[model samples]
Target: MDAWLYNGKDADDVFGILGIRAEGSRSMNSRKLVVLDEYINLFNARYPSAATDSFIVLRDGFGGEADFARVLSMAKLRPESERMIANTSKYQGELFSKWMVEDMLEPKGVLSTVLEGGSYGTARSEDKLVVNHYNVFYKRRTREQ
Candidate 1:
């Protein structure tokens, strides 16, 4: 497990000390989190046809990223899709400039993900599980199986 995680990433061999009794220190790095609220605005600007939708619905009842991305994948999307993709890529590049690549790059590209843990399904102690580690596993080699 340890080797799988640290194999190509831990260039300093930092993770190599995991099981050994070792000490470390830390400090706070100040960073300004830029919250992007331009989605609705940009959507409206780029897709004026969507303006008929209620603002309340747009604000409080935004659809899932999967739904958005799925629609975005359709072939005929025009000004809106182009603008959205361009702006999202811009935001990602901006974030990476201010932070570590590890902090900015995400599996879903434009969406943040939550971590999941615990045994997969109904696994016994000896059973090898093939859990979907989601973002992390997808970013690297398939952790499942």
Candidate 2:
């Protein structure tokens, strides 16, 4: 099971660390957006990694399902440095949203992959970038009903 811990701080830090730039772009590709939206629904429907599931759901709430999904898709596709900035923005928005609603909840991890220097932030590592077994059990092993 791949994984990274986040304590909720630091833009450069991976895992559950809170970052600094949690408010950047919200716009993204429509097809990837659709894929991400479905991905979130799958996450919610499955009994996979409980830790990250709650975080993703909670983060979705902050930006609205659509907005969060866009950010998430972008983050998934973005390079590490770009993700550092983009995720920071998204995470910050979610935090503020939760605070304003007085929910006082936080996500477990902020999973992001490293990126090569490129424009669409499409650059990725040859190594597996997924941070948890959520990808394994849900995305690879499970069969669709």
Q: Which residue pairs show collisions in model 1?
A: none
Superposition TM-score, candidate 1 onto the true structure: 0.19
Residue 37's lDDT within candidate 2 is: 41
How many clashes (backbone atoms < 3 Å, residues ≥3 apart in a chain or on different chains) does model 2 have? 21
Native-to-model Cα distance after best TM-score fit, residue 99 in candidate 2, in Å? 2.6
lDDT of 1 by residue, 38-138 (tens): 33334445547644222222112223322222222221123234444554334323333322245443444323231122333343321111112123334
**Candidate 2 structure lDDT:** 0.35
| Number of backbone collisions per candidate | 0, 21
Model 1 misplaced regions, further than 4 Å: 1-80, 101-145
lDDT of 2 by residue, 45-81 (tens): 4524432433454344334543443444455556365
Estimated TM-score for each candidate:
0.19, 0.24
